[model samples]
Target chain A: MTMKIVFQKTSGLTDKPTHYCPGCTHGVIHRLVAEVLEEMGVLEDTVGVASVGCSVLSYEYFNCDMTQAAHGRAPAVATGVKRVLPDRMVFTYQGDGDLASIGISEVIHAAARGENITVIFVNNAIYGMTGGQMAPTSLIGQKTATTPYGRDVSVHGSPIKVCEMISVLDGAAYIERVSTHDVPHIQKAKKAIRRAFETQKRGGGFSMVEILSTCPTNWGLDPAESLEWVRDNMVPVYPLGVYKNKATGNL
Target chain B: MGKVLMKGNEVIAESAVHAGCKYFFGYPITPQSELVAYMARRLPEVGGLFLQAESEVAAINMVYGAASAGVRVMTSSSSPGFSLKQEGISYLAGAQLPAVIVNIARGGPGLGNIQPAQSDYFQVTKGGGHGDYHTPVLAPASLQEIVDLTKDAFDIADRYRTPVILLGDGMLGQMMEPVEFTEGTEIRKFAKPWATTGTLGDGPPRTITSLELDAESLEKRNWDLQQKFAVMKANEIRYETYLTEDADYIMVAFGTVARITMNAVNKAREAGVKVGLIRPISLWPFPEKPFLETRDRVKGYISVEMSAGQMVEDVRLVVEGHAQVDFFGRTGGIVPTQDEIFEKIMMAAGGVTV
Candidate 1:
């Protein structure tokens, strides 16, 4: 007799089925962001920037006004949008290679300028779209197509801790590193995403949540194995929790 | 505003403000630095936003973002800095965003000297970025035209929804002349229904993107872009002619060199050699209409420039071998003198009959 709605998809995401390979955690991360925006009820007034790599097509997935940016320039593009439409929410969904390598200058200066925007940086430890090339966030001994001999600290250098690096900027209002390894961590990741967006809604300035995602296809592992890989390998190197919180002076 | 003497670079900022440009993002580079500095000072007074970006790369991408957000936005740089902006520019073109880019060109190829050069002619007209797209390039020789074309550049950009370029040189960037902004000039509005302003209510969210994964779709996008370009070429092709009513030799130049060639035209007339000047204002369109009437009458056209014969290629293409296409140029920031161009006029006039 009772026809009531149960749990359903967020309106912040479109019904378009994702192109992500089976087991990749990008879909989960996208859902977290979309759910946060939907919960905040700012999806109608939000602009999302889809960056290069696998996330380059996020504009098609995110059910909001979106823009596809040049490789490594999403933050700069977000800055432009936020500056023009100050009342509207603007954020960039960037991958590790797009955010840490070619786009390092854009991200650093956008933080340094305290541009009123948010960055949802997805760090999968490899260039997923380019078929598993070593990323700027690749682990020390992790082997990708480019680092076929296992990443060597002697030549390849160590991976960048984006949350740690961006946290030090005076203009960065909030910075966090979150993981999607399990149900609990995924819940926490959603909270972090909400905090980043909330920080922007309050004009807190330059918020970023660096998500530790799993690239099962590129990592040469199944979905279950990939979650273990992130928990066993990535968590130790990139510890979870907020690195910088403008709200409680490092809450 | 009454006529006031201002440097060519400063006029660009002043006129842009009058044209209702709400945002300017640029990095400091010599020659064009004054444009950035002027914007820094003036934009705040006009309630506009001005940002000195970290680099040209960041500046152009900012412009791309602003344009996508549906506003009048622009960026300025020199040759070296402009090179850094190429990828972002390509992205803008791919998305068909409206933005203005001012290039106060200097010597180049590899950190070349900061002297004025027209060597960037190819870079401006022939798709400076990697794409099958073309930016409408405006080359204004005089300071007054700088004021006029700066406004026109923004209008053209907004009107066509394409990146419009103002191709100045070190000379145009530095020279001073009287310019007046017409008081209370109404800023024309263009409807940007396709912009991604994040204000879509109940409607499906729009995406401003250039990446079409499907080959057929990308080709269709290219076809649409080409059609827009065709419309722009039809409505925006601009150039000015002088003393060419019955000339035997036509001198072609743009920017500062065009001014010098005008003096050379007078000298050629004084020497009883019928010579004229064709100052191509819209350098990308190449002003083929002017040559259509004079190509048969003139013996040949001499392309004079501060660089080594870049625009001459376009001149030849337009002339179609009906008239000899000669080149008189000095590379590496060398500004050709009035007499130097007169000499080329005289040489081309030596034997050919009109």
Candidate 2:
């Protein structure tokens, strides 16, 4: 009997091993992005901007042309790349600390300018690279290194719902919040990533996919429990749905 | 081509466009606002990109992005705005991306005023960003020189694969002069096989990054950068000497201050006082050779500036105690008049005539 190969590495990804922690879900997100680029036949024409975070080394993982940006400046850099080479597809991979905390202005302004680029935002609700400090997206009752007593709303305020905030911008043509807590949600997240790229390929203005990810190491949970944690805690605050899709109707 | 009188800032912008810089990102700051406005109107006509970034920090990062894509890009700002861009500049230097930056310096220890000042001489020439790196800084004294330097800056940046700064002051930015746009100036293009514009199956995908987690690798990168800077120092020192031969006193100046010092030199010569001037065209690989060679002959050196004696430090370093180096400056946007500079030179020369 002849063995038919059902799974093989996509050309969009490089041969180097990833540095992501086990059950971190960042690996899954990376694979999804690479697969989408390969399937869309834009792997050779894509330019990826890696933000300063756990994914700071993402430039090595992506097979397409990549540039590493300073902490929180990925969107601005992506804006430059997209504007200069409008025909080339550009995207930024940013984590919660990078996209929501220090890089808020860059992300907002890039979207507001209607820059034709895609953004893949990974929100794991904590700063993963910097040893689990309190992140802007840390849950209200979640315990973190800085928020050892669990996040208190009176002290730390609330988590920023990025998809909702960005969807309201006039320049953002597509904005979706997806999760990778379950196999079904992972499939849905891949679909959202594809749609975001589709928006860019079709000349639609700023598109973003905010994927609710898990940080098992930082969250002090085992691999399996971390996915459940994301499903039970993160999904309620950041609802899994398309906040704005110009092609379809606004939610 | 016929010469047309244009504002210095406008000329710099137009010259950059002529040099094939199709992407410009900047913010509005006085003394350099005209450059941004000119780019806004002109870039579209040439099918280029002109984006007015929200801040200078964003603007420089945009330049970084465009440069990484293997294209000519630039940004312009005044002192405070330039300070905000230091972080991005450091990244660009670390990544070895080629780009041009223009600083129409205004007065500042902190937003001092909106007038011309050379206070930023140390910050720019000595690496304004947080790193052990040097950006090749070119100082232009006239509108024509500004245009020429702006064009040359792009080429030099590409040649070295490093950021080059065109450092001017408010006077240089706001003043008007007749600039002849010379056609067919030799434009040199460098091979950017390292740029992140997709490899197109030619090779592995390129990565432009400055982060090296390993201490040994990072140290090696720094050493390599220093070697490149040393090469620039050897090949790129530029200065103009006026009546330096058979003179007792030499005034070291640059940019607008150099123009004023020239007037002072002529006045001192009229009074039978032997005075010459050394105008440093490139401030980074500062014209140390001129100072060293003339140190023995000149009685004393007067460092003319529009700040609180910044460039004098570099002069002193080069002079190395061969002669006394005195500083004459008018700080906080106060430009020294011709008479004032001449008087300083007269005092430095011990009230003696040749």
Candidate 3:
């Protein structure tokens, strides 16, 4: 019997190792994004904007040209890049703290303007880079560093549903929320990533994929348990589904 | 081409187009909204981009992105809006990106007013953001001067791989003057090998970032920036002198105040008082040579300004006890008349209270 290769790394990813914490789902999301770009034949003509969270160093892992934006400014930067080079595909990779807390205006305005770009939003419900603080996406009862005794909805407010908020904008061509917990869900997340980039390639307008990710270290759970935690706690609030798909009229 | 009467703000916008600026991102603000409007109408015609950004902060970061992609980009705002752009300006400096920023200044400590004032001299020249960096600031005294400087700003920014500011007051932005765009303008092209444009099989991908986790590396980056500023200070000092050959008193001013002080100098000369004017064209490099050269010949200097007392500190530092330096100005959107500045010059000359 002849041995054959079952899998290989995509050319869209650099050879360098990632700095993500062990058992964090960020690596899986990164691989999925790289695979999507590579499969779409846009890896060479793509520009990536990296945000200011744990993924701040994402520029090193993405094979395409990358520009690192200041905290909460990636969408504005992506708008700039896309406007300057409309033929080139542009996307922003941001965490919940970057996209939901501080960068809300930039993202909203970029979508409102119908900027033809893509966004990969990783919602892990915690600020991972600066320690495990309560992110804007943190669940109402979730315990974080800042919320040592579980988040109080009355005090801290409910988790932001970014997909729902962005979907209401007329300019948003596609919006979806997917998870990266299980193999089946991982496949679905990759499909959403592909659709987001396809929308940009076809000049469909602003497309975003909010991935429900896992932060085992920050969640104080082991790698396997974190996935279960995401399924049990995050899925109910986030609700995995496509919020808006302009091509399919699935709003 | 004959001269055409143009508003200062519009001329700045047209000049950026003539200088090959392909992207413009800005928000609306007083005294400078005409600039944004002009770009909106003109950029699209020339196959360029003009985006009315969500805010000044977003506009500046957008400029950062376009500039990193190896294109000439610009943004304009008034005082308060300019204050919001400082963080992005610092990041541009840290990333060594070339960009042009225009500030049509208004009165300010907070939302002071939307009238011409030069209160932002220190905030601009001293690096308004949190970093060990400096932006080369150019102060234009008239509509034509602003047009010329706005064109040259792109070149200066690219040559130094740093941000260049065209600092004008509200009068400069709001007033109309005869400007001939075809004369004395040189079009030069620059190569941007460091831009973050996709490699496209030409080379490895480029990464434009300001973040450095290691302390030693960050310090080294800061030192490199300081060295670039030192070179700029050495080679880019610009100013104008009027009748300073045989004077006992000199008047120092810039921007719109410089033009007013020039009239004041002529009036003082008619009264048999030997007074001259030193108008600094570049505020950061600050034309210190003029003050150093005239220190011994002049008995005293009167610093005229639209602010309380901003540029006077720089004049005092350059004079360094060689002569007495007195400050005279108005504040809160108030502009001193030519007669008011003349009286201050006479007061400084005679050592009498005015």
Candidate 4:
């Protein structure tokens, strides 16, 4: 007979309920991280690096030790923590805007330097906390508060595919792009997170998991439609799969 | 854990290691380049992480990544480099990340000069970064303070979860002084239960972020930061005064300039000029209380700085029409001689040549 396992409380999140909007994938992503930590049993030794963007108050959500970093700087901060506490697991959670614009320099170096840390990057395409500003991952011809018309490539540039870029870095041990729009995708994402964490545990170089997430409110779409939009639009530009894996050739 | 003579820049890098800082991200900038070189050599020995980032921006971010992992980390830069770091510094402050930043200040307002300058007075004290936040700044007048304050900076940084700056000038970075390393003080191996060292134990993963959407909530966080700053000011304020009693004019300076001003004070006193000096050791809370209390007694004040009239404005604000305040400075890679300072003092003292 199968015994029921009650959901465990996450150490890094706060006791307070989250403030995420309905159908928002942030809550799901948070749950995935918690479940992964529960499975890994390193919650006590885990220190999370926070980033700027919609999830800035993510410190309140995790029960474990959490340190909030500047935008795109979560990787840098994680490097610091992991360096000092070499035995402890360090990871940073950042959104697209935070990772792409202001924190680009930090992200590139951390990956290039092969910092023994994990990066849980949430790419929701639009800037949710900043009121629908066009993000670096915003689709071409996408409308945002900042982009009254469609995003112009001549003026604004195209969406950045981080996983692809990071895969090119020789130092990056593992680079993967996954989504959370469906159950299969969620499972894949969990596996990706596990591999990233495992790589760090093995003293592997930098590992990154780019989650193609939803910002239904910001995207002005229903939850289902937003997930579909991600599947349709984001996946083409940012493909889902392990772009680079040092351990295995293919799945 | 032994005594040794070292420069201010060298001590800062050494102290970070002693405090269990295992990661250092920096790029070579003038005056503070020694700090980067020292870390590059030593960090590997201790199994620490060291990398020379491409730019000051990258360096600051690397520091950011390392600090987020709940490790003690640091970065050092000069004036122009500090300007590039302001954005990252603001983020660190806003997020309540504990890290150390050493600013070996040089002349500025552009690619100003490579010589020592206290030009970053407003930048360091007033939170040059874009934010309603304050970084607890410790100004080391001597090399000893560099060692002591660097360790103290890590303590205060971790305790308060804020960034702390060890503000020195190019002169202090270059000048050698004797320092006693704390013998047998066990290296602090702090346990950050929330760092992302792979989620172990029966709990959920944590996230560290600085974003708070609700204006009211963000405002409250800002308020909390202000409260912390207030506490730091009350507890962390430090300074030193030399011969302020019965003096007609008091010279205010810090770092190397303060050291120079002291020589000027002694020379002027020998010549019957009746001058004193107020050397600020902690530049952030700015030793304002003592200066204000002594404001009524002194007839005039002179600000000795390497920049053009930065600290003088602060003195003027505090003096508040109580005394005549004047500024004497050498701009852009120039260090004024003791004779020039003495002349400035005599001129400030009714042109009575000493």
Candidate 5:
């Protein structure tokens, strides 16, 4: 006999070709998030908040209920919704520029308060949606439109280590960083996403999963080379591991 | 019908909850802080939610969130803090979300003073935040009227699908007045099925958003909002007229200043100065009809306020240069006395032709 699989039909995501460039990691990440909600049977109860950067169209891709939040304020909006309806599953899908820049205070406070919510932070190291601007995570001496020669530490300051900072907060019950370069890593990333959602549903505190993603178009790299860069250069700066996990259920 | 002694701010807060408001989000601001403190304790007792947000901006957004969730929500602030809440108010109006905001008017161009003033009349009645929008503003002159109008604000807000502002001054917030409570009134549970609240197996989830990028569609949304506002003006315009029949002069005022003008009117009547008053209960719709009707019968009008002549402009527009209009006010935390207003009214009546 052959095994069977069924995908969630109620998701707000459409079947149209995504706006992302070919081999970009956003599509895979979107599917992983939708699949987690589908697998958990909370697709109807989920409310996804889209960010200001590249994922601004995220509301169009997620099949569940969705809202668009201002740059860096997704966590605050999600906090409002979750506080009003404690039983509903809520999450914010944000990019590096949004999570680490203008919205840093909201993210840190929500995490420090141990808010029962999930944060799907996509770390592409560079601003993807806004035409490859240098991001907070833009590596030192890393070349981009804004950092033409390289990201100079003195003027720009060092890259923000969000997951590490959140991991130490007593309110954060689960924190992890994962990658999406290969099948095994993709599988591990899915597990991390599912864990964060589960911890939120179990009435535990804050949970975050940082996915080290590739932006080939913005990175000025070929499809294969972008994946290679994420594996080599990015991995060294942001390692893949379960930084902290107190509610590691089956996944 | 009779007065019951109560701290002005606490009365307004308790009256809202008693009127069936189940959610409040506010950050502590002076003068109006008691309103938040009372709601913090009282709302939870009624199974309502009260959150003291990180900042006034966050508090107003939280009210936006709850209002979008289809619950009756409210927030309060003084001048400096209310300025921060303008962004959320604009969003609420754009989204057509119903909520209540209390502006206990204080002196300011910037935290100038904590004392009372009617300076925010223009800010409240004339699209305070931005974009082409108007919020229904209720001006309450007494503690009893505060409770009564606070209840009416929710109904008007939801009916119009716009934010409603109860424009009071620091004096109204701090004074004590007698209040009466109503017997058990059943609340009308209006649910926003579009909300993310667990829908109990409902069909699809609802989303509350103010964003509509499509130019034509957004224009249509704006047009629809204008139509709703038109209806509100037609039906919800409220005001009180005293001794206008066969009077030579009329005083136009509102909020705390209106109360003082009332006293001046009674004094002017005693001294044989045929003076009357038109108190605007709904400041945004503005009761233009009442003022327009008095044009044929009355002499020149006198506008008394706490600011340096803001609402006077609206009065002039309605009067349409038909009568001579002049303004008398004290700015930056100074309260104009009833005696001073009486003297102005007497002088404007006929150069004290005594």
Candidate 6:
């Protein structure tokens, strides 16, 4: 009997194992991006900026020329690289702590300038790398190390809705918010990533996909429970949809 | 190019362009704003780029980016802006990227006055950023030297794979003088095999990072940087001495203060005072050879500056207490006059306190 292979690893990822904890969805998100790059056939011609956080060592995992950026400065570093090499594809993989807390200014300015680059924003709603501190995207009443009494809007500011905030920028060509809770959502997330890269290939300015990810260890949940939490909790706050599409001018 | 009249900051931009610096990222600050404006108008003409970043921090980081891409990139600012750039500077040094940073000295601890001052002496020479690293600081006293050293800075940066700091003052930035640039000279190029331009699919991917989590690895990196710095010190020490051969007193200064003391030494010579001048061009390698040569014969050395005796510390350190070393400075944006410096020289030699 002859058997056909149904699944294979992507060439866009290196052989190195990731340092992310078990039950974490970062591995899934990385695979999605790597698969998209491999599918697009631009993995050889793309440069990636790995942001500071758990993904800081992502340069070791991505099968492209990579730069490890200082906390929150990946956008600025990508801007420099893309400006110098306009034909090469450039993107930044950033976490919520890196993007929303420290790097908010860099992303805002990159969008304002309409810099031709892609941004992969992973929102786990907590700082996973530094032992589960509260994050800028942490949901209301969420309990973390810093917010032991649960997040209070009276004390801490509201969780930043990055897609909503970034979609309003004139320079942003494509903006979407996706989730990684289940198979269907994960497929949709891959499609969004492909579109963002496609936008960049066609000289679209400032494409971003804010992926609602799961942090099982940090969130005090099992791998299965984390997916349920994202679907039940995060999806309500960060709705899954394309917030902006410059090509269609549709929300 | 033949001699043409130009402002100090414009000279810096044009000289950098001549040196093959096709990319400039900077934020607008007083004194150094002319350099940014000049690059804005000039870089595009040469098919280069000039990006005005949101802040000096972002500007330096942009330079860091371009530097990682193996291009001759530059960013400039005044005192407070330079302070903001310290974080990126440390990153650039830690990553061992080649770039040039210009600090047009101004009065500061805060938003001090916009007038020219040498208050950043300690900040520049003592390694302004946090790291076990040093940047080769180049001090150009005249517009002509600005043309020469600006190009040298780019070359030195690329040669060592390190950031180079070019020190100037508000006087150097705003003043006008005639300068001749060596146009059409072939810019020197260094191959950067380590730059991250994307993988070629034939090799493993390259990662450009400064983070070394392992203690031994980080310590080794520090040692490698120190070894590189030793080579720089040995090969890059640059300074000028005038009449130190048979002088009774040697006066030390740099940048604009050097020019003033030069004139002061000349007038004192006409009055038959045995005075000389020594100006350090490469401030970090802090030219100790001149002091070593004249220390036994000279009665004392006076360090003059636009600030409160910062470089004098180095002068004293180099002299090794062999002779009396004194400091004369005018802080808070005051440019010391030639006559005042000449009188100080005369006072050290004799009692002529004019």
Q: How far off is residue B189 in model 6, in Å? A: 0.8
State the lDDT of candidate 3 residue by residue for B1-354, as single tens digits: 789999999999998998989799999999899999999999999899999999999999999999988899999999999999999999999999999999999998899999899999998999999988889999999887876788778988999999999999999999999988775566787888888777776788889999988999999998988899889999988899999889898889999998999998998888889999999999997889988899987899889988989999999999999998999989899999999888887777775434
Residue B316, candidate 6: Cα error in Å is 2.0
How much lDDT does each candidate structure score?
A: 0.91, 0.93, 0.92, 0.83, 0.85, 0.93
Q: Write the per-residue lDDT of candidate 4 for residues B56-135, one digit (tens) a residue.
A: 88778767666665678889999999998998888888867788999999988898888888888889888988979888
Residue B32 lDDT (model 1) = 87
Tens digits of per-residue lDDT for model 2, A1-251: 99999999988899999999999999999999999999999988999999998999999899999999999999999988888788998999999999999999999999999899999999999999999998899999899999999999999999998999999999999999999998999999999999999999999899999999999999999999999999998999989899999988673
**Residue by residue across B149-255, what tens digits does model 1's lDDT show?**
88889899988889999999998999899887788878889999889999659577999999999999999999999999888889999999999898888899898
- By the lDDT metric, which is better: model 1 or model 4? 1
Query: How high a TM-score does candidate 6 get?
Result: 0.98
Question: What ranking of all candidate models by DockQ puts the best one first?
Answer: 1, 2, 3, 6, 5, 4
Q: Candidate 6, residues B1-354: lDDT per residue as tens digits?
A: 579999999999999999999999999999899999999999999999999998887788888888888899999999999999888888888989999999998997799989999999999888888979889999999999999999999999999999999999999999999999876888999999888887767677788888998999999999999999999999999999998888999999999999999999999999999989999999997898999988887999999999988999999998998999998999999999999999999899888776
TM-score of chain B of each: 0.97, 0.98, 0.97, 0.93, 0.96, 0.99
Predicted candidate 6 versus true structure: per-residue lDDT over A1-251, tens digit per residue: 99999999999899999998998899999999999999999998999999999899999898999987888989999988888888899999999999999999999999999999999999999999899999999999999999999999999989999999999999999999999999999999999999999999999899999999989988989999999999999999999999999988674
Give candidate 2 regions above 4 Å deviation.
B351-354
Off by over 4 Å in 5: A1-12, A21-23, A126-134, A142-150, A248-251, B1-4, B198-200
RMSD of 2: 1.5
Off by over 4 Å in 3: A1-3, B183-186, B352-354
Selected candidate, larger TM-score, 3 vs 5: 3
Candidate 1 lDDT tens digits, A23-70: 998999999999999999999999999998998889888999999999
Index of the highest-DockQ prediction: 1
- Point out the higher-scoring one by lDDT: 3 or 5: 3
Point out the higher-scoring one by DockQ: 3 or 4: 3
Write the number of the candidate with greater lDDT, choosing between 4 and 6.
6
